[model samples]
Target: MTKVPNVFFICGNGLGSSLACQMEADDVFEEAGIAVNSGHDSISDAPSLNADVIVSASNFRSQFANTQIDPKTKLVYLDNIVDKNEIKEKVLPVVKKIAES
Candidate 1:
């Protein structure tokens, strides 16, 4: 069986915003007919996950700037974690591509 791509959501703390984003992403991918394994974690734990895709709030961009991530991992940023439209727009294409592969 093909392995599903992992989409990880990151935030300052693992328990809050990242979890919210992960939930939204789950719905977004499901509605778009894409299959992925989604997760949530603190920014500090991000590099260790090595997920196929890493997503975070736009504000966290600099936190990941110097962190060494796998070259193949796709990074997605969202302006609003609760906005489904923004999540779909920013993440669907990347998830689709990874799912297809």
Candidate 2:
């Protein structure tokens, strides 16, 4: 079985966007042969834990301070916390490749 990629999602405030992304990853990636587990975390929380990807809600993007973020961590900056379908369509490819490796 392929190991699903974990995604750590962050936002400016504790809102629905990050959680939405998590659900999208589960629905979309699972169909594509990937297992996904995502969590709501702050920018500061990211460096310590391991995650295959990191996403930021569009409205609260700057709170994510990219300079402090590790270059090795894959990131997806969504535009205005769009629909779950959009997140799934965009993120699945990366998730698929990462799981395969």
**Candidate 2 structure quality by residue, lDDT tens digits, 1-101:** 57767777776543576676666666666676666777877666667658778877665566665546666768777774546666766676777777777
Cα lDDT tens digits, model 1, 20-61, are: 999988998888877888889998888899699999999999
The TM-score measured for candidate 2 stands at: 0.75
Candidate 2: stretches off by over 4 Å: 80-82
TM-score of each: 0.93, 0.75
Candidate 2 Cα deviation (angstroms), residue 95: 0.9
Candidate 2 yields a Cα-based lDDT of 0.68
Against the hidden true structure, what lDDT does model 1 obtain? 0.88
Error of 1 at 78 (Å): 0.6
**Residue 42 CA displacement from its true place in model 1, Å:** 0.9
- Model 2, residue 87: C-alpha shift (Å): 1.4
